[model samples]
Target: MKRNNTFFRSVWFIAISGLGGFFLSLTGLSIGWMIGTFLAAALLSFLKPSLLRHDASKKGVPKYWLFIGQCILGIELGQKINLSFLHIFKEYWMTIILMLLLSIFFSLLSGFLLWKYSKTDMLTSFFGTAPGGLSAMPGIAEEVGANTAVVSIIQTMRVFLVILTIPIFVSLWASNPVNHVTLPAQTVSPFEFEKLLWTLVLIGIAYGGYLLGKYLKFPAPWLIGSMVAVAVVQSFGSLFMGHDMVSWWPHVVITLSQIFIAASIGSRFHKSMFIGLKQTLIVAFLSTIGLIFSMIMCAIFVSKVTGIALITAVLAFAPGGIAEMTTTSVVLNADSTFVIAVQVLRIIIVCVILPPFFRLLNYWEHKKHLSSHASA
Candidate 1:
């Protein structure tokens, strides 16, 4: 009976959150469904004890649902990979490398400000400002012995602000009106069996890659792995078949995935995370603003140097998650392929480079403390 009630409550929460998303979508906000559901779930979490019954059960959206969402996102991103994008990368390799370095520098600067002003520990502050995927950073924070709650909250807040602000800014700044591009319809194979077989093969590849990535201890393994796997398979298949592989991702599936992901992230908040709330929020907000401003300047420089569109450069440099930024690029009819590639490369670089540097910092701090203690 207890289990049944808990299940029902969880369902109710998801339903309410989805409704919030639906209403927000009506308002024409970028990523409205995700933003609305996240806000709604977060409000419920915050108000559980005061306005809501104390006995109301708190439950998160299932973890697998979040994983499923990641897989779908990975596949969608993978579909954007092609020979033409590779050509773009080769043409702009130097510019891309410069942009990546600038992004990392700005992130570190934000992390330092947070550490200096808010007294957040080094690891937590860095991870919170790292501009990696929201789902990935908190886990990395915990692995590095940081406060996961603080990291999660700061990361989420930063993403929310980026998503909320960038599109409006771009629309206003661009000389032409923002045009939304409708995705082309999927090209289905004439043979039904062949289509089913191709989809099954793609799923198999995603699963296999996910397992392999887990074994190898890759960062955000499932997402990165699935994306790489799908891209490889699609590329090979296209070479043999003489046409691009069509994505199975549909609008409804993507929206549902967004809802699930948003609800999960929202439910992570706890009242305990707010213990030093004002200071934390102020630092996070300011640091995020600083990061955004830095990226905008970098984008302008890149645009001028490389002759890429300013909007495309900005989207590529925006310190937001891959899914959110890519969606924005698609909606705003920017260079989504470039945005995804740059964002993915940035994530890989951060994950690979930050941990060792953090460990070195920890080692030095420990040594310094021990030397002082010995003198005392």
Candidate 2:
């Protein structure tokens, strides 16, 4: 599909997306703003394809909206990073690595099952099942000769399931520990000039980080790059400058981020993407449930071995988007820093290692298919 280059044509769609987010926010769900926006955009695309140009010939809303949303989310998560994150990372680094490996193993296993049982091709199944960032997998899969439509649909479904189920599970079953990582208190108003100045600086830093991340070829560079840059400056500003950076940002900003992200994602969905994916969708759905369950059990083990809170372990290891899981952690009073750290590490590992591995698999699958046809 061609890019949706005209921003003016997208205004009405964006407005409806925001309205969807606003109404969903009323549900009091921690991630309702995102989910509501996603549903609205998706429904609009599916119901009235002409309005958004959600068809085979053209794309939906512009990509900049999602990038801006990710930048804001990265900054929000980066601010949650306190000096205590250093301690947590230092102490549980090995455990974190092991849990990530286990999670990836389960993800691949699920993908294998999907490929074997469903009618989807190997590349699509594998990329769809990978717990990499939702924004990264489809594009990467497309580059490697996978079905981008299938990968995108499946990846979105997986994230949607994880978002709806895992958070609720952790909140209900896992106990919140009293030893939460605490942030330093700030007594500044949101509209204070000093706070506003620092906020502007942070925004600039986010852009710089994004540029650096893009140069380094980081997956989801806007999100990860801005996150790391903001986190480092926010976490260590006191040691270098003899003063803590502003500790408080407005909640409305994060809400806006959620709306942008949700709208962008929802706009990507159309009936065309799901036309012949019935069997594949069913298989992917079941495998996703199994994958989520497997991760929960792994989280249980990680919690027992590392002495981390169960809820923290669950959120850290669960196969969900970084922003969604971190937001849930904050709402439930769990360890947000730890969750973000693990989530970031998971994305890094998956992006660095899995793409080439999946490409190898694709090659072998193609070879085998050619051989079978030759014999026939």
Candidate 3:
């Protein structure tokens, strides 16, 4: 019972942190709140690396909670997927490619600069400088004996700074950053207890699937399975039942859900683990230059090819992850969709590209060392 309570409390902390940051962003209070929160999360992580490190929770909540979040994202994304718009946007594909190449080029640059200046090995330094997940890269970094700590710190700090600065920058540059959309008040056509019961059953399915995923030691099992299952069902229902099957779901529920996400992300930051502040500050300066230079190149590339606008591409392709780019795009009034799509693509590329590159880098470096020793 005590352990269960602690889990609940921690999850609650995480959600609340997300909510607090979202509200602050909406109210225009702290453009930097998300970064502040992430920084706090890193601090929390350093202090208690196990704060939300529950393999169980990581395994469990997504089926029930995270699945719902993904559906919302999909719904938003699906709504935006216009065939006509895409046809027009098709010409921009080459531009997107150019933008992607620019990201890769700059990522290489950031890696090289870090390698030259720092004691970290080229391979670890290379992957460590990657932008997506601090967790994902550091693990890869350590396997080959790269400076995982430096990579972890640099990546986290890069995310931290992006989250803090991007929104403020976007809002400053955008034509009209705050354009809140109000949804129509929902009214259900009729009550069907049978369908309601089934929806509850589906939620239960998600719950159980998440738990089972934990047992299987799957990564984000809850999120992956629940999202896949619910999405499949939801998509099928829309195809057959004709859009009215899920009318009764509440906005209040969604808002609350988003808050939970924000808080959970925020609680990642605790007050400890900020020792040797000068070293952190120095690395932060270098990382900032790298991110800025990379973003500027991306923005210029988008401007030349897509002709969509410079600032939007820059905000979208900025090396920071989804949360920062999404929030900043919203706050800055840039094309959030464009920003998100590119960021998502960036993530996909990193997840796919980083591992192979790491392996190759190790092989090449090892061969180089052996050659040098033989010559000596």
Candidate 4:
């Protein structure tokens, strides 16, 4: 009986989130579903005690919702993969490398400024500002005893800012762009047995890949694993089956996925998390803006040098989620595959390089504090 009640309350909360997403979708924003769901979930989460009648109502949306959303989104993106991505990467690998490195450097600079000026400790500030995926950073910070609350808030803020701003900017810029490559849309076929067989196969692969990724300890395993799994299948479908896999995706699936993911993120926010961090919040906001601006400047340079569209380059270089940015790229008719590649690479690089560096900084800071105490 208790479990049933909890399940029902969760359903009610998700219904509210869906309504929010639906209304926002009516406004025709490319990523309206996500932003609206996020805002709604956060508002409800912040007011849960006063508005909700049950303790279960105050609990966050389940993590499984996020996992499922990521899985669906990974499949969606994987369907977009094709042989041409190889050519794009081969042609501009150097430019891509430089842009990613510059973006990381800019984020590190912003992290440094936040550390110097804000009340947040160096580790929290750096991890918060690292442009690592929102899902990845808070967990990593917790392992190192950094302030996970602060990391979550700042990472959420950065993703929010990036999602809200980049789409509008890219849409406007795309209006007058010339000489940019727009990737081909996925081939859609009507529902049939062949499509059904392939869909089942892909779903199995997504789940299996996720488990494998978990075993291997990949970051955002559900997303990365499923994406890689399906992409490989789709990319080599012709070699094995002598034809492309038929995809019969509904547009609503993407919107629902966005809602699930966004709601989960928003539900993480609580009023208590911000109880005593006014100064830190303000500095985080400023540093995130600075970081965004720096990345935009870098994107502009890359656009000029690589001949990619300004909007495409910006999406590629933006410190945002792969799923969010790639969704925007698809909606705006930009090169989404490039955006995914870069976003994935950036996350891997940040996860690999920054954590150890931050650990070293933490150790050195600890040592310095101990020496000063001894002298005193």
Ranked by TM-score, the better of candidates 1 and 2 is 1
Writing each residue's lDDT as its tens digit, candidate 1 over 1-376 gives: 8566655566676667778889998865546677687778777666652222234323355455556766766665565666655656788889998899989889989988898899677887888898775655664565567776688678878887887788778877778756664533424335465666676778788888788767877555566668778777877777677776664444676677667766655565566556776787799899899899889999998888878988889999898877667777776778888988888767756765776676678678788989999999
Q: List lDDT for all candidates, in order.
A: 0.72, 0.77, 0.54, 0.76
Of candidates 4 and 1, the better by lDDT: 4
Q: Please tell me which model should have the higher TM-score, number 2 or number 3.
A: 2
Lowest-sum lDDT 10-residue window in model 2: 178-187
For residue 270, give model 2's deviation from the true position in Å.
3.8
- The total of clashing pairs for model 3 equals 22
Worst 10 residues of 4 by lDDT: 49-58
Where is model 1 poorest over a 10-residue stretch in terms of lDDT?
Answer: 49-58
- Residue 30 miss distance in model 3 (angstroms): 11
Question: Which lDDT tens digits does candidate 3 get at residues 115-214?
Answer: 6665556775677667654424544454455554456567767765666665556555667555563322334335577666755755765666556655
Rate residue 295 of model 4 by lDDT: 88
lDDT of 3: 0.54
Show model 1 residue runs off by greater than 4 Å: 1-9, 46-62, 133-149, 160-196, 239-242, 321-337, 347-376
Off by over 4 Å in 4: 49-59, 121-127, 132-190, 236-246, 307-312, 320-376
Ranking by lDDT: 2, 4, 1, 3
